[model samples]
Target: MARVKKKIRQEQLIEKVKNKPFLTDEELAKQLDVSVQTIRLDRLELGIPELRGRIRKMAENAQNKVKAIQSNEVVGELIDLELGHSGISLLKITEDMVFGKTQIAKGHFMFSQADSLAMAIVDAPMAVTGVANVKYKVPVHVGEKLIAKAEIVKVRGNKYFIWVKTHNETQEVFRAKFIVVSWGEK
Candidate 1:
């Protein structure tokens, strides 16, 4: 019975990590109701790399595909990307990113994350946001991690319409629609 339960737990661990590769061992332990050491051991037995290695592998895959902006210029870490189609980025709000008193993150940081993601998805050598319609759904506090996903909706001539949604761990915190103009290979 113990072996059976261990097998089941290992399967759950694998599924959770497969779906959300960025989850740290601590987070995985919490979600699985297991100790972090157990999680690490399972990961080792399963041949799964640690969170940082997983993220680095993902970033390396997307780095070569980005064309509109330099990898370093992205407001957040670009974890997943498919040029001209969609992409995902992760940004963690820190002390310097939030207001000292309220602890609410500066709005521009969220906007930049979404905007830069929108620009990065354009299938051009270069792209710029000509217009942006955005809404801040809720205030995000420091220590919260934001996951922003961008999708290109339509294209007309040089203009690409992109929609980006930013979410904290719980719910959506921000969204934006952008009109990006692409420049032919620079």
Candidate 2:
């Protein structure tokens, strides 16, 4: 059997927190039992940027600062636009996007990308992810570009079922079904 070799530095760290909650550099370093500098180095090499403004945008868009308060630091941006039932977004995965030495790209990052796009399409004051059924089809690599395409598949009262697909350049990388709950002053 051939061992799968990691092709990027971020991949090493991403493997550490695939399905887990997001963590800060200090927190991740401590959890992995490594030095902060080591974690920083890994992040720098993997092109993972800081996620400082991410929560702010989500808060502003959601119109609910309290709900947008995020405890993690994986940053992604909305690089595409569409409205009503469908939209697209692009997120640049950085070193902070990983966990240890595996390049799976943290699941939350992908989830956020999809969720945010869904919110954008819904054009509601606030949107929340109620549930999600996601499947990882291929491993995402460092320096690889990711694109998320989302569409509302169904809607019931405050709940909406959205379908999202994430891709890297040429292949479909991740797919998810998101159940989002949006609220506003009706």
Candidate 3:
């Protein structure tokens, strides 16, 4: 690959991360057709931190807004929340989340993140997940950050139909529709 000018490479890197902060250095290197070391140096020069750091930073900003469940009990960090409407969260897949042989994340982690986000979006005192229809679109690996976005699709009486879709930078990893029973509906 012809060498991308340092300035152009930095600009592209910034834009890439702007679009998806969860991208790893290796992924960025592959996307930009540059060496990983070059990518690292470019990130450093551009005042960008490593992938995990970036994820933590993004999650830190929104983690405190969680209401339905205690922040620690939720599977992921609650980054954005608008009760009775929509919300977003972040989950970082770790070694413990993956199977030993395949290195693919266990399914429960994704479900937990989605389910919690679904419950969090209900604007009631008590929210319970009555039924979940979920699908795993792709296998996730360790060190990947998942951004889960949840929207309240419908509300009938005390029941909220919520949709959650989790994705990495390039593709969807998990999607689910949750029927949540909000006990304290006005």
Q: TM-score winner among the candidates?
A: 1
Better of 2 and 3 by TM-score: 3
What order do you get sorting by lDDT, best first? 1, 3, 2
**What is the C-alpha lDDT profile of model 2 across 45-160, one tens digit per residue?**
76554444433343344332223223122135443333445655668777778657686678777777766666666645567778888888887766777878788888898887
- Candidate 3: tens digits of C-alpha lDDT, residues 1-186: 335577788899999998777679999999999899999999888899998888677666555655565667667887666667888888999898999999999999999999988887777777789999999999999989899999999999888999999999778989999999877533
For all predicted structures, in order, the TM-scores are 0.80, 0.56, 0.67
Highest lDDT, which number?
A: 1
Query: Model 3 off-target regions past 4 Å?
Result: 1-65
lDDT of each: 0.92, 0.64, 0.85
Q: After aligning candidate 1 to the native by TM-score, how far in Å is the CA of 53 from where it should be?
A: 1.4
- Ranking of candidates on TM-score, top first: 1, 3, 2
Candidate 2's C-alpha runs over 4 A off are: 1-75
